[model samples]
Target: MTAITADAIAFRAARDHLLTHRGDPAKVGASFRWPRLTQFNWALDHFDRLAREDGDAPALWIVNEGAGEQKISYARMAARSNQVANWLRGLGVRRGDRMLLMLGNEVALWETMLAAFKLGAVVIPASALLTPADLRDRIERGHVRHVVAGEAHAPKFESVAGDYTRIVVGAAQPGWTAFDASRAGSDAFTPDGPTQATDPLLLYFTSGTTSKPKLVLHTHQSYPVGHLSTMFWIGLKPGDIHMNISSPGWAKHAWSCFFAPWNAGACIFMHNVARFAAPSLLETMARCQVNTLCAPPTVWRMLIQEDLAAWRGKLALREVIGAGEPLNPEIIEQVKTSWGLTLRDGYGQTETTAIIGNAPGLPVKPGSMGLPMPGYRIALLDAEGREADEGEVCLKLDDVPGEAPGGHPGTGRPLGLMAGYEDSPERTAEVMHGGYYRTGDVAQRDAQGYYTFVGRADDVFKASDYRISPFELESALIEHAAVVEVAVVPSPDPVRLAVPKAFIILTQGSAADRTMALDVLAFARQALAPYKRVRRIEFVTELPKTISGKIRRVELRQLEISRRERGTRDAGEYFEEDFPDLKS
Candidate 1:
């Protein structure tokens, strides 16, 4: 009855509003503006206030192996994070300082994340799966000043030289601070000052499939506020439990698991495991009452392979979305047939939040990545920078400096765009040229405003003067019953310059022999036109992927060139000669 603080009232108001307006996009979008505060912090302004007297509100939920579960309330998390903030501050962790956080989906991960946010330190989230070399590169390039990792990871850093404090989350070691000791400090948090909206909040080292990793920087406002678009895309509401299938260290993890859902006042549910089992994951989703779900195309492909009928009847999963890459139309149709749900696909890079997405309540196009978000202005520009029906994807920037959001008249600039690639202004200039931010990906936009993702700018190739999108061919290949995963690249030919070739990974109970390859090729020919027909096929155990799980088509392309040069006999390579029954 103390005239509840502003932060508490905001939290309750926002949460209740989202609950009352669930599935009502117009109502929520019309009223939900990011809470603006000149002297505000998410931890101090919202999280701490929600924690006050909210002893029963579940804030963090973790499900470990063996079905062991742990639930922490808002009050408990607030107190624990305050202690961490105090303890970290004692170790010279100050505002704006960069800390490399490498851990699994543990409670300490969330605790330290909140504490860093409260103290206004920039966090570089690293995956626990990274090798020592990866860690060394991150430490050297990321300008990281501190590290928080598990005791098991400490030995990896022993050989890497750094001038930062080591805060181990598990057991205490010599010259290493134990995360448990944070509980001995004060529970009360006192920030040195208010956090600036433009101050750096997170730095992510992305898994570069084509080049070295780039440090993508985000501010407090960028991810936290920018994700308003992402929340809207998924149509998440307060009190809804959202489960995102992603590793802890990747940008997608922060995109869905951390910022997006939390921005919508939704609870984050994490299922920690050593490896993914589709049935077990489905069971967990059913048991946890996961309302909204998001995963990559690879996971969806695996899920579709399972007996989906066994898990489809569950009603908690109201919204199903896909990201990380385009959702093939075949997967979408399969989900619709099995579960009566449409898997919406969203598109964005590590530099931004959900810029383009198939928003909830909209009619979904099977192969398109959907329309641009509310604040986005997308353009398909030709090589000459003129608007075209199909070309490279570019975000138009405002002609005038410091213009209004989305720019004034005649000024169309990319909003929610990255500041620049850290320490590489030349590289930044390459992408951010002529007032437009080039995505380096190609796409085509129909007259109806739907955008379909073509292959990467480098992956799209010309075979006999016809432009071919490797993604399109790969998507077609994935539809085959025997194909588990596939990557399409251009193989050099004597007459046609290059031809579409597929490297396939077979599913269980399916053979990767020449017979199976021919069967898949026949299916592809029946499903696709002659122009897009896969000319050659090779079965491989695994497709090369970046650490983030994106197929490295460049690597495959180079391998194809070398194979042609050396005339290598691929494991399951099949050519027209193998099927010479057809007329020439």
Candidate 2:
């Protein structure tokens, strides 16, 4: 515990300094440093400290849509997690064992996460939305030794034969252990030993929009301590009610739900909805008094479709932001006009914490992902691996900001960075090559260092010798009244080598007819540069997306290539040449 005590002191100094100069980016940048840690157990050392400070203060507050609700205090959560840890240890959940956790938004989810942290076991978080087929891949590929899932999903694993222990939450199942039995365990737990900061804590399966899902590895230090930067970026403060709308499986869930809010000593607020509806979300926010809010661009886009003026001044929400996708300028402006709150944008991945974000009190530049965060040293490198104004967004793992670029990890490698891909060292080396962690997502950096999202390297295309960004065109298309959502991909063209084609989702009242296609094409033509104009359009009820809501542009591109090769005309497809006025 000596290492934990010392680690806590160092960690708090960095956290308190950020909190002290919360508004001044210059002061925060100049003073902030990642705490050097060797041995740290976040649940045992840090969370327990907060519980001691406020025995009765609310730590977790949950409200289901228009129904039952629950609140757990810091003391109660600490004690309950300790009991769960003891019970898990009794069931032979030893240190370093991988546990598959699949549950919806519930109290047990939080308790199980903390208990696993305390016990030094690795957790592989899975979305409840995952089918039995999906679960098979995780259990086999993840080398799962234990499983904690809702009772309803227990039958899914009936055919998945394995030597893993099964623990159920809701009701008694045939072979699974009931989580309720843990409540009878004593509210006391002592760890077998100190947790090394490098010990594996989380193994995440990436959403895999581009390819097969890769196993992402995070250490105890990577998330628990690393989220301090996230806390500062979100402008979280002690006792603040932070509600981030995210699913249970993804990295963003842990980024906002588990580690970031708790790192700031803020209360975790959750509103479970059977289905996400904008009007109901606003009504609940008004009733719950949520202070700081974070949601994906999809939710924000949907929320804007509601008469935002009627929902204005409903809640006490102060700091609002969007992540998981690039927040379009139109959505940000709508929220600002209605709620008088700028919906800030942040950029990170399953492999890292918030690397670049529009930190609090900073100017929100339209279409820019603010400056790099305190702990990260960002470098935009071109395809040739040379420094460029626009290229792949990379983290300087060789050094932190305010230091020379090529320093060793001891001098400063970001604590927020993941350990590596679990079983794929070759893939890890590919990303961590040249002393930088390459985020596959590309971007353009302005002179002021604000990074604007370019399409993914695979998503960017050349048409008529001019480079075009799908995100740029998609951003413009979404602004049109008839366009609810859109994905821009290259369509085959004999003249220009390739042309931008938009697959669009129409709004509720809009039709998927020729007139609507002409309207959208005309809208895009007026908004885009001559070379970047969308030449083709198609209407679809929905775009193929990962469960996490990221449009698989890769899939869309494949469909276009196949259609072109097979000479099969896609139904509901419309081209600029089809409309005489638009062609002109």
Candidate 3:
């Protein structure tokens, strides 16, 4: 058994503090202090310790649709990762080397992540969906030294030029090392040296929603220890089966799948399918008796379309959460009505861990993401950087003690925040200046301290001198039965200068014709105020989305602007004026 270090003890103490005060956010916020450690390697100090104590306990459980299931115990996982680390070291892997890891939700993904951490190698997680062009950009800009990918993704590198080492996870490919060969290596491994708390560990490429993807760098202490707050927000407990629906390569995957549940001594559960089917997913969760579940709003929206009440009786779910986007109030209400559980919403960015969330045991306001999590001091700042009721969401960077909402004393810098954008100091400075890290997202805080998301700073526009939030209009549009997905953008108008126009994807079997458009427009007229109503509708097969599944409103806005300049209208577009019988 590995001897636990003092740093690991401090980390555990902080984690246990949150577990003890799990039900009281106010108490946790006021008292919790992030452990100050100069030398710490979470995989070695913390995870290994857990493995030593609970060797027989299950650490990872993955279920495939027709392929059956795989359960790995803590002891087995630790030894496998140790052997992989030793094998990789023999292949010239060392501390600080950047390795690009692109694989699906298979066992190799977990084994490689742990092994990379143990070997002190920096991992740049890439989605298997990445194209050759995407891989080329990541390799050049990320300064990658090694590549470890699944066999299916190996052919993509044929067109990508790089000098990095190539290793494949499945059946051997020519010119690529077979990952299976690592089994011959010994299961006892040792680190080259002590890893500093601030040493670089993971480099994530942000899903390019508005512009090019930026490389966001995280330290060993930032994500590994920073996710203690994430565990608290999800209300995880020892032996609980926690499942987070997120694709690998994104930061949220690391937030829940890798760090958060492990921090709480919970089993990480995954259900892999060829494609997402709401009915099958719900059934699996019920069969597996998953205790806590966290999914993006997109998945939640799809799940609500199925008969939720029928499955509620068979499920053992205790906590449900929505993330990746602002959840609609209608979905929350429906879930409560059907399952008797509050669908909590959490807010964060690729740049940080879960900063604000409707935590367990806290009163959830329908449309609001809840108060700041422990160790975070949230401040809404206007354009001039002054505190405001509605403005850009920002985090205090200074260590000066201040009072947060509910009279909780604000701590210093949160360990969850990223180190900075790699190789882009000016970009980093722009967001980290003014004694705060600006999130670029705007929100309004209520008097009672809950915060409701408005929209992206750039997505908010003006119509007839009134400021408009596209998210508000989009949320309202989503409530319609025929609307499967929607992105609201400001369309150029001769009279109002700009009006809210919706790019909509209709539900299956719904017609994209005049009758449907008029029906949706009438529904919007009754549901929203005159200024906030969706004035124009365009029925489309699909809306533009980022690779990570976020709606690309910026692209839609640009499309509208280009159409206006061209003096043309889309084939499926309908104006409010066309619906003469509909009342505004």
Candidate 4:
């Protein structure tokens, strides 16, 4: 048996405490403390220990559509990662070296991640959906020293010039090393030195919905140990089959797929489908007996479109969660009516773990993303930094000296937060100043401490002196039957300066014409308050989205601004004035 480090024991104790009190949010929040460790390597200390003890337990399960599945046990996964790590070291990969990892949901992705962790190298996760321009930007800005990508993606790097080592996971290409050759390397591995808890581990590029992608850097402890909050939020248990719907290049993938599930001894389940079909996804989940499922609001919206009740009898789901975006109350209600389970919502960013979430066994208020997770000290602060009922969501950075009112007893810096935005001190300082890390998101906290998402700070606009949250309006508009997806932005108005204008993607079989726009505008008039009502509607086939599937409202807003300057109206756009029927 391999000896465990003191750091591993401390981490295990912390993890066990959360697992033991998983159902009791208050107890876990009040008593749970992040393990203070000086030297720690999660893959070496914790995961290897779990593999040694439970060698036969399934660690990863991947099911491909129309293809056979792959199940890797804990022991085999460890040995495979060791071989990969040894091969990478032979290729001159070293600690602190930045490696750009771009691959699909194949088993190689997980193996390379573990191998990188064991080597103490920093990983820059990129989406397979990225274009050559995107890859050029990431490689140039990220200071990449090595590249590991799928054979299908090799052509993208042909135009990308860099000194980085190129390795391909599938068919071998000239000038690129074959990833399969790593299997020939020795399975036994040894580390050169101890990995500090603060050593850089992962560097993530934000989805860039509003602006350029910012490089968010995390340490060894931030993600591997920080995801304990995410584990609590998803209500994971040992031996449970956990499925998280996310792409490989994004942060949420790591939050649920890699760290959180492993932290709880749960099997990370993946269903690889070329296209997303709600019926097929639910059927697979039921057949696989997946216990915990976390998906984005987009996926939830599609899931609600399917006959959820029909699969309820076949499913073994114990908990369901929504993240990436705020979920609509109507979707929540529909799922509850069908599955008899609360679809909890959670909020976090690429810069941190699950900072705020509706944990398991907690009473979920509709549309609220729940309270602060076990280690977070969330404060809604106004523009002046004063605590407000509704303001930007910020996490307190410095520990309070004593028992501050409505605050946790002086826990130091949150273990989950990133070290800083890589190489951008100005950007990091902008968000991390004033003793708080501003999330750039706005939310309102009710008296009971439930935080409801507003919109992105910049996405929130004013119309006729009244503040309008695009999310609130979008949520209301999404309740309409004709609407499939919507993005609400302020349209230029002569009388009110600016009014809410909705760009909507209608449901299947719905016409994108004046009649449909009028109907949607009338429905919005009825669904929203007078000031918040969507005054104009534009029926569209699609909304601009990031590669990660987040709606890019910033682009729509910019388009609206340009159109207003040009004094032109988009085709299929309808104003409430055009329909006197809605002029109540």
Summing lDDT over every window of 10 consecutive residues in candidate 2, give the lowest-scoring window: 403-412
Residues 202-272, model 3: lDDT tens digits = 99999868889999999999999989889999999988899999989888899899899999888999999
TM per model?
Answer: 0.92, 0.97, 0.98, 0.98
Alpha-carbon local distance difference test for all models:
0.80, 0.88, 0.90, 0.91
lDDT of 2 by residue, 1-584 (tens): 22338888888787887777876454466667788888888998889888887868788999987679999999999999999999999999999999999988899999999999999999999997788888899999999999999987898889888899999999899998999999988888889998998999999999888887899999999998888878988999999989999999999999999898998889999999888888888888888888999999888889998888876767888899899889889999998898888889989989999988898899999888888887777889998998899999988766546767424222356889999988799999999987888988899998887889997888899999898999999999999988888999999887899999999999887889989888899999999988999989999999999988899999999999898878777788998998988655
How large is the C-alpha RMSD of every model relative to the true structure? 3.2, 2.0, 2.1, 1.8
After aligning candidate 1 to the native by TM-score, how far in Å is the CA of 185 from where it should be?
A: 2.2
Candidate 4 TM-score versus the reference: 0.98
State how far residue 335 of model 2 sits from its true place (Å). 0.9
lDDT of 1 by residue, 195-267 (tens): 7666788888878888888888877666766666787788887677888888888888988888777666567
- Can you tell me which runs of candidate 2 are displaced by over 4 Å? 1-4, 24-27, 400-411
- Please name the candidate that would achieve the greatest lDDT relative to the true structure: 4
Q: List the residue pairs that clash in candidate 4.
A: none
Q: What alpha-carbon RMSD in Å does predicted model 4 have with respect to the real structure?
A: 1.8
Model 4, poorest ten-residue lDDT window? 403-412
